[model samples]
Each structure stands twice: as structure tokens, then as C-alpha cells.
Target: MRLTALGSRLRTTAWPIPFVWTVALGLWGLSREGSVWRDEAATWQVALRSTGEISRMVENVDVVHTLYYLLMHSLFECFGPSTTVLRLPSVLAAAAAAACVAELGRRLSGNLVGLGAGMAFGLIPSVQFYLQEGRPYALVAAAAAVSTLLLVALLQGRRNERGRWIAYACMILVCGLLNWLALLILPAHMVTLAWARPTVRTWIRWASASVAATAGVMPLILFSRTQSGQVSWIPPLTWHMLIGPAILLALAGVGALLDRPGARGLSATAVGLPLLAVPQIGLVGISLFKPLFVDRYVLFSLLGLALMVGVVLGALVEAVGRRSRSSARWVLPVVVAAATVALLPQALAKRSPQSRVDDVLAAAEQVERLKKDGDAVLFVPSARRDTKSVSPHAFTGIQDIALEETPERSGTLKGVEWDAARLRTEMLARQRIILVTDAGDVSKPADSPRDRTKLATLGECFRPVVDEQVRGRRITVYVRSASDSPSRLRCSESSR
Candidate 1:
């Protein structure tokens, strides 16, 4: 009895060590990360604003990320502005998720499976990719994993424990709120529950929990629908979308390497198959019409893949040096370690600014070097202007000609734009105007709205002086044709 009690204590204590290591890895080099990604810049612009402004912004856009923005807002008020402060929540949430994966694995199999699964989750390149982000995807991944853990407890709990069931329902609702996309995991849970074939009362409890969670998430999805244009950038689904599922399947087959057959396989399949399939398949179905597919969107599903692999590896480890297990034991550890090393370079690159669409800091530096006091700036296609959002400090000496109100004042990521005529008038009044644009976008044969306006008016009114290309974009300086100035370029008179 004492030996059993000692074993329990050791197992419990062992849990957090892996959890802490996973978190430390996630948080590594976070402070040194340069040129916040465009998504993180969006967080900075929206979260630092007043609550009323944030509310107004979400009502028109990014309603999908409302809770995450509010959380960042609260953090900003308490800690002031810094990348670390903005992203620490994600780091902690991901750590909690890694730990939850371990705990859930232990419940399904044992400690060996739990430890291997948790470590695999921590080392997944995709997992590390999102954990360091300032956005809500990591939290989404965490919430999804935790909700699954809660479901496991609810399923196994005694009949008298109604409160655990209630907590499980509430947690599913919370996960949906974190990322409505997360609710897709529930269908997978439904499959698991169906496989259990519980008594009528158990079925009722499961039905009640599912209904409550669905009811809670409906309103969020409805509001998010109104702002659906925010994701217009997601191209339609293609064959590439199937690759995530393919990779997961390949990994699952690896776990089968140590399968004990029969009941072991069924149990693992019951837990693992649904997690790997339902969320992804549902998303793919939706993407058939909407193209909402991305690996990060279903990042939670990877935990299931990790758990399945861990179970097999654990079996091999436990049956050490016995018959076929002799070679399997040594091979499993080496394989896992080798897989992690293979992923390290790409994982490390994800930590650097190169992983993002553009280097906002580097572009901001060039703009600083070229601009004179009071120079006017116009960003072609407009959205590329997000570069300034992250380095708001560098544009102090210049003016945003098309910008009518700042992001904070307008309560939007890029701020409100003046009408085209007003923008043209503003541009003509300046001695020198700077153009910020993506290299490909700028070189396109067709003119974007802002591009057309800048070309039509600035073409007739001003002349290009000098232009240079930066990391992922181009910057040009246009000088007024020595004839266009507010004194000489007054709009009301010019129109007449």
C-alpha cells in the first residue's frame, strides 16, 4: 500500500516538470523577436484603444477576435505596452495545453504515454509557431485541448457527480467563445459518446451538455458572420488543404508500430480518430464553399495525433527488452528525438521576423531615412499601411495624407480614410509625397483604387523624383511639379 501511494505521488509530481519545459521552449527568444507580424500589429492597434473605440471597431470588423482584444486591452492597462506583455497569455495558455495533453494521455493509457505525448506536442512546429504569436490561435489550441480533457473527466466521472458534467458543458461554451471554430471538435466528441453507448440518463446528460454549448456559441457565430469580409484574403480551398490530414495519418501509422491489437487499438481509435477527423473534415466541408481552411485553424487536432503516437511509444517503452519489444524500445526514443531535431531549424525560423509577410521594422527605417519634415505619405491599396501600425513612432515627422483619423480615434486597425478627392487635394498640397506599396501590387498592370487616384492626380500634378525597394515592398518619393502647392493647388479653385 505504501509503495502504491509513493508511486501515485511521484507520478503527480512528474507532471509539471514536462509542462514547465514545454512553456519555456514556447517562450524562448520571445523578447528578441523583431518587427511584430501584421496580425500582432492589429492587436496593438485595436487593444491599446479605449473600450468604446474597441467596441465600435469590432461591431464593424474583427468581431471574431473580440474577447482576445479585450484581454489584451486589460493587460495593456496593467503592464503598459510591450511585445512580451501582449503575448504572455498565449505562452501560458499553450503551456497549460501541453500539460493537459499529458494528463489526458495518462488517463487514456498511462504515464509513459502521457510524457511522450506532452513532449511531442511541445515540439510540433505548428504548435510552437502559434504559441509565440500575439493573436488568439494559441489560446484557441489550448482551450480546445482543455475542453477535451474536461470531456474525458465528464465521461469517466461517477453518476452522482452532476457538477462535473455542468463544468464540462460550461468549458465547451468557453472554448467556442475563444474561437467559434473550436466548437467543430464537439462533433468528434459526439462520435466518442455514441461509441460508449451510455445508459439513458448518461445520454441525457451528454445531450444537455451539447445543447447548452451550442446555444451559447450561436450568437457569437451570428455576429462574426456580419464581419466575414475580414477573411477575404483566404483563397478558395485546394488540394493543398488535404496535406494536414495526410501528415496526421502518417503520424498515426507510426503509433501503430507498437499496437497491442484488439481492445487497445479500439480504445486508441475511439479517442484519437474523432479528434483527428471531425474538426478537420467539418472545416474542409465548410471550406468547400467558404475556403476557411488553414493548418493553424485546426491546430487543436494535432494533440490527438500526439496522444495516439504516445500510446504506442509508451507500450514499447514499458515492455522493454522482451521479445519484439527489444528493438522497439530503443527505436521509439531515437525516432521521437530525431523528429524533433529535424523540425528544429524550421521551428527556430518561425521565431524570427522572416516568418512574417514583411519586415515592418526594416521598411519603417527606410521611410525614416527618406522623409523630410511634413512629408505626406500614401499607402497604395491602403492595407499595406499596417507597417506603420507596429512602428507608430517612426512616422512622427511625416503625415498620413489619406488618413482622416488615427486608428485609436477611428477605432479601426488602419483608421478611416478620406474620400478620394480630399486625398488628392491633400497630396497636391505637399512639396514631397511618399508612396508605400507592395512590390508586386505596385507593379501590377491594373491600378487599385488608391493607386488609380494617386496615379491620375499625381501623374497630372506631380512628378516622380526617386523610388527605392525595401524588403518586401517599394517606396517612392514624388515631388509636386513645382506648380502644385496649396497656394497654387487650392482644390475649390482648381476644380472650377
Candidate 2:
């Protein structure tokens, strides 16, 4: 009796132990990963660049969210711009999001529901992946959670309660600044509000505030639109990818409709709509135009997925209790165990060292040793023109003048035509030229054999210096004929 009473007292507290456990799990998963992949590398590069130069860089490149960049810029300034430092903000943001989910769950349902939702979020594979990445996706996820929570509070407002309205507006604006996808969450809000039957005056105030906020965000939308044109690799969007999320969403909707009055239906819709809408829209948009659907772009939806899963599990437990009251004791544990089993693979993958940015840096370091002074590194064939599909932007340690076909296609450097003579002349004027080509490009059968022979002809003009492996692919470096000249002298000193 004494032990049971103590357990009950502990469960009644605001900060339950299960909520703490869920947060710990999220933090652990995020900290296990150490790699800053390609897009992450691009984010780091942008953040490292001077704030004064950011607007100019964004004009030249394709960056959608200026606010995220600005926040990362500030973070880099304080943290000294290493991969770990660059990624820390996202990690913390994701952890905070898990906490917020639990808090929201507690407010809507009870401690058990909140704890389950938080744990589900913490264990999600996609959530773990984005939280460990050095990008804005994790922040977006956090903002989405905060926005959902605020919206819920607003819907549940009492007579003479104006504070929740202000809070809701502020959360929406902050989410909008975080990413354009925040706009996607608005339809969910509108649907929920219409179902809730709020007063006409409240609706008018919300709509007016929303219009003003949209007007405020117009400059950013224009800037993003201008940058979108530079991306040439966007693919068509499709409907097939929407099937799984859509089915799940329908189930969630049914669950909401079946829910008892007051908290159940409202909570179900709050979690279900965003999860269903963002990805469904994103995937469909991607099928039509390739630029739109990126896996990282839907990181915010993981929160909704977690919530939906938690609600379903909670409802299942309730159902089981109605059939066999004795089974209720085992239901929560069984749900947690099943979730852990499903999430094990993703949790382990996040911690693997093979997924790190240091691998690319190491490869670049190897290339550096073989080059003489006045060397230019050529990026052969070039990457996809779309910013969305471009290779991860992280640089290895090797620094060389990059060659490409179009500046728009390559994020960091301008593209140069494949002129062997011009390249040789540049190398002779300097002392060495290192040509790095993706082996996958070489395997393609469409290129003229003569054009394909460019590397061989260029190799003949210079001495083979070094060939290094980066992420399992060989990148060869070559020295110019005048390898012993003063240009080499300058190159040697500069490389050091």
C-alpha cells in the first residue's frame, strides 16, 4: 500500500520520470552521430562565410530560409565553426521538440499519453537522423511542435482568454520564419478551427493576423523564388509516395472521429493533419517538379507521426482494458517494447562512424600531399544543377581551384569548359592541376570517347602525383610539366 501510494504520487508530478527518459533517449540518439553530410556541409560553408556576404551568396546560390541561415551564422560565431559546433543547435532543438511533445501530451490527455508520445518521437529513425545533422530541419521540427501546442491552447481558450491567441500568433510567425513548410501547417490549423466552432470574431481576428503575417513574409518569398530559378535539376512530383502517409492519416482521422468528446478528437487531429499534409504535398510536388521532395524537408512531420502512433497505441490499450481489465497492466510495456524493436535499426545506424564528415576531409588531406604549388583542382562533368539534389556540400581538406561546366550547377565555384589546352596553360602558369571526377560519370556510355579521353590526355601533360580514396572512390592528382618552377614553390607554401 505504501509503495503504491508513492508510485501514484510520483506519477502525479508535472515532470514525470518517463518524460525525462524520453528526452534522454533523444539526446543520446542525436549525440551518437558525428557526420555532416553534403547539404550539411553547404550549411556549414554558408554559416562560416561573413554575415555581410550572406545576402550576396544567397543571391548567387539557392537558399530558401534566410532566418535559419542567420541563426546558424550566430551559432557559428559563438561555437568556432567546427562540424560538432555547427550541428549542436539542431541537436538541442530536436531534444527540446521531444520535451514539448511530452508537455503538450500531458496538457491534452495525461502523463501516460505524454510520456508515450515523447518516447515515440525520441525513437523515430528519421528524427534521430535529422537531429544529428548540421542543418535547419531539426529547428523546423521544434517550431512545428511549438506551433501545434500553441494552436491547441488557442482552440481550448476560455471566456475572456486573449493570451492564448497572442501566443498562437507568435508561434505561427516564428515557424514561418524557420521554413516555408510552416505554411503547410496552416491548413491543418484552419481545418481544426472550423471543426472546433470558434466565435466569428475570433476567426476574423485570426484571419486578419494571418494576412498581416503573410504580407510581412513576402520579401523572403520573393528572394526564395528568385533563387529557385537557378536550380536546373528539379524532378517532377508524383502521387505514389503519398499512399502510406495518406492511409495512416485516414486512420488517424477515423481515430479522431471515433474519439470521445473534449480532449481525444482535438488531440488526434492536432497530431494527424500535419503528418499527413506536409509529406503528401511535398511528395506530390516532387513528382511534378523534382526540386520539391527531399527526405530532410519533411523532418517536421516526425513529430506528428509520433503523436499519431502514440494515440493509436493509447487507444488500443483502452480497448484492451474494456475486454480484459487484467491486461491493462501489460499494455503500456508491450507498446514500448514493440516501438523499441521497430526503432532499433535506426538507432544503431545513427551512431556508426562510417557516416561522418571527417571521411571526406581525410580524403582531401591525402590529395593535398601530392600537389605542387600553382595547382588547380577540376571537378569533372559537374553535379546535378538542382540545389535540392546536389551532392552533400562538405569539403574534404584539399583546397584547389574547382573546374565545372556551369556556376549554377556547382554551389561553391564557377564552372569551366573542358578545354585541355586552356587547363594545361593554367597549370603550366601555376605548376600542377588535380582532376577529380566521379567514377559514376565515367561509367555513363553517352559521352564521346574523345571527350572521355580528356583525363588521359591531361594526365600525359603532367606527372602523376597522387591518387587518394574518398568515401571508397579514387581521386587522382597530377603535377604540371613545370613541376619544379616558382609556381610550385608558391603552391608548396600555400598548401602548408
RMSD of each: 4.1, 6.9
Candidate 2 lDDT tens digits, 205-234: 678656666666667767777667554545
TM-score of each: 0.88, 0.77
Runs of candidate 2 exceeding 4 Å displacement: 1-34, 158-163, 250-258, 263-265, 282-291, 320-330, 353-359, 368-376, 381-422, 428-432, 437-466, 479-496
What lDDT score is found at residue 164 in candidate 1? 70
Q: Which stretches of candidate 1 lie over 4 Å from their true place?
A: 1-10, 158-160, 253-266, 323-336, 441-448, 455-473, 481-496
Each prediction's Cα lDDT score? 0.74, 0.58
Q: Please tell me which predicted candidate would have the highest lDDT against the true structure.
A: 1
- Model 2 clash count equals 20
Measured by TM-score, the strongest candidate is 1
TM-score of 1: 0.88
- Summarize candidate 1's per-residue lDDT along 254-302 as a digit string, tens digits: 6756544332233545666688778888898999999788777888888
